[model samples]
Target: MDVRLGHGGSMFFVRDALRKLTLLSLLFGMAFRAAALVPENVVVLYNSSDPESEEIAQYYRQARGIPEGNLVGLALSQKPQISRDEYNRTIRDPLRKIYEDRQWWELGKNQSGQTLPFVNRRPVLAIIRGVPLKIGGSPLPADFKSDPDDPISKRNEAAVDSELLLLGGLDAPIQGVAPNFYFEGEKRFEDSKLSFMLLISRIDAATVATCKRMIRDAIQIEKTGLWGRAYIDYSNRHQMGTSWLNSIQNECRAQGFATVADRFNQSFPRNYPLSDAALYYGWYDSSVSGPFLNPQFRLRPGSVAIHIHSYSAAQLRDASRNWSAPLLEKGAAATVGNVNEPFLQLTHRLDILNDRLMRGWTWAEASCAALPVSSWQSVALGDPLYRPFHHLDGSGEEIERDRDFRSLVKLARKNSDPGQRLKAIETLAAKQKSGILSEAAGLEALAQGKRGEAQKWFKAALVEYQSADNQIRQYLHLAAIARHAKQTKNAAGILKSGLSRAQSFPNSAALAEWLQIVEPKPKPKPKATSGS
Candidate 1:
């Protein structure tokens, strides 16, 4: 009766993997087109009032080689949130004046020697460094007519980063969230009907140190490439949000990236091992508490993780609290969080975010592409120009170079037939001796109820893994295999070992939580009554 070795459960999952791979192959045929704006087209905006903000701006400019003329200093509040009136005066008016002065971009000349119109020369990207996160909504306009049937229609508030996209139209009385002109299926920036579509993002977090590191991480990863797995977790609250995550996971697969998507209503698993995560999108949680708390867990450089709970950005100074700072402290290069309870609908669109990045949009562009509101609740933190997949042309050739990618391909094909699946497992084992591939083989073995084979593959994956940062996920996976073998004590021991190793690592929040899950105290057996 020990379903621990249940054939039905294991075999069903094998068929599921094959079906997913077939669907993934079909969707992989979508065309990839490049975006219009490049790094040189961006203008960096920094607060002149805050010394740390100014320093971060200078550091970014120097590191990115952004033109000195492209740097724009603004006198604004050091506070994280500002009023609409103050924002209008300090941000809108000043930026409008600067654009009118034609200082942000170089002027083009006509054949007749006349200067080209300002519309032709506006910067497409606005890199707002160290700006306030949110702007309090202004009172409804006198002519503001709201449909009594729709409560969301009266949304007059905005995230500061989101509002800046409409800097040119700030004078107009805006309603709720501004529509994203660069949304998916729309023309790229150059071909769009709109004269301007400025993509805005910020380099900000708890301190200037975190901001500086974010910029550095972005720079490093763009060059080396964001090589790793993709994890998408959704609480399945809003169908729209869940759909976005679903699309992202598919796109990741098309690009030959390994992905694990959780469609459950539960939080991310406490002991869920995440390895070499290049991109992660999960939400509906309020704070930095979950499987992510495993101290051994850290996102790879240039990884962008967004948690869509209201007030997740309320506090960024402490890594223990809000999502943004902890993610940064845990090694994510960039993150977006809500300073206030920005409604679920207003959160960043995962599809748009993923699509833009695939199209060579920079970190700033991709981060802001799906945001529906400005001067409201959300704030983005990281280098504005970090483009993780900028070099990947979606040809799959570049992805094929990574051993893990090759292994994933083999593993995905391991569900065709008994013979074919066996061949795939053998081919993967022969091609590379990597931890990732071994772990994949181990998972496949466990799924087939081959406990001995699973143990061999998992142990092989875990051996000689010196750094906890790189092997935490492997440990967790191995522990999972142990659980399948009815070896709870062994799984607990593996988690404890990972916890010890993670002490010296950057972020180990997930490890301790994982240990708790694997080693939960045994419940006492019920005592029988004397003679019931």
Candidate 2:
């Protein structure tokens, strides 16, 4: 009755099945573990003296489910910038007492059950909500002699969040001159150094509503995964600082991102076509008065943009000229800039920031890790909880839910073998699939001059896909095919249908603009004007 296979063959088949199952299980487990930068791991800090700050913090606490114990409100000045004296008296001293008295976190336990200094139960992120964004350092006494031996003595002012990176140091007159223990190569967070304890980020914008919008955007985009293109702007000067931007291009490629890099000597051009841009990293511009200020330069929702310029965040509420506010106003989900002159060596490193972000770290974690010195000049603006790559290594089941990820994976694998690519296309098409994979396959067919076959695949994409971006892509491609076939009316109709379907898509402006070019308005009848 069971003679289809010999004993040895049956055993072999069973063993092979078990091995594949085990492998898949392991990969899925890894994906699950890498899926999130836990929201509960962040503590929200607010200024008790500022009603606006407290209100914002309360809203975030409820929205994010932060435990009551994690909410720390400090009484302090509401000024945008505070002097060293005010910082010590109103900020540092009180924060230290709260940490010690309230047992904000317990010391980490050693192997033998004794507690260790650096290791602790502290949350990884401290979000400063509603406090002054920057701090000014105290001047050395005039009679004090300059000491070449002590580098810490030469510092003048620092960012408040940067200074607080030394939360574990509780020692008097914390100099903030200590090295960033959590910088690139160091063990992150759990290491017991005072300087490496808590990473700080901020949520701020031109107003409270703007701040809330930024937070909601970060959460929404991370869930769906960021899509579209990346724009990298490199300065022509070849200065050491500007040259680092080149690394972003390489990293974006490795992350399987579509990118447009501008290495031109000039700033971002006034009429640069910045369509579908999801990421932007540029520098050397002193103000936010560049081509990006154009009304049409709206960044895709969930876009992360930053620039390298001293004092670019000097005033976040000044929406016209500062980097932070302008970027936020232009629809960027998150950004970072300096509150003062953070010299090249002290500024956050672009390469490191890019790497950490790609590795699934949240905006706060990446910014803090890349910062060479905090409490001096850097200000992270946006939701600290934003993690752009949280699902990069997610489970296959989760990957199936995202059409963009499927398309990227298909692109990466398509060139490895032509025969395999053909087989995959045929197999996917036979199943009546509608997804980015199908859309990409159709595009490949079109590239090979099989226009009719490509049109079929695109048509399937419009019916079967669920992602708004992929649906728009299918519409655009279908419209292009119609235009190539000399059917101008058909092309215009396709675009109009897409706009009707995806009315609120962030990049729909491109479709609307294209329609104007292809189908201009008809002039009014001469008889109507004359009333004849």
Task: Kindly give the number of clashing pairs for every candidate.
Answer: 20, 9
Candidate 2 wrong stretches, greater than 4 Å: 1-37, 107-119, 147-153, 170-176, 186-196, 394-406, 413-532
Over all chains combined, what TM-score does candidate 1 have?
A: 0.73
C-alpha lDDT (0 to 100) for residue 481 of candidate 2: 80
Q: What is the C-alpha RMSD of each candidate to the true structure, in Å?
A: 10.7, 16.2
* lDDT tens readout by residue for model 2, 426-523: 46655756464566567556645678878888888778777675677677778778867878899899989988988686556556755765797887
Question: lDDT of candidate 1?
Answer: 0.64
Q: Which predicted model would earn the best TM-score?
A: 1
Q: Residues 113-190, candidate 1: write the lDDT tens digits.
A: 433222534445444446776777668878878865343446656667677765643233445444444544344555
RMSD of 1: 10.7
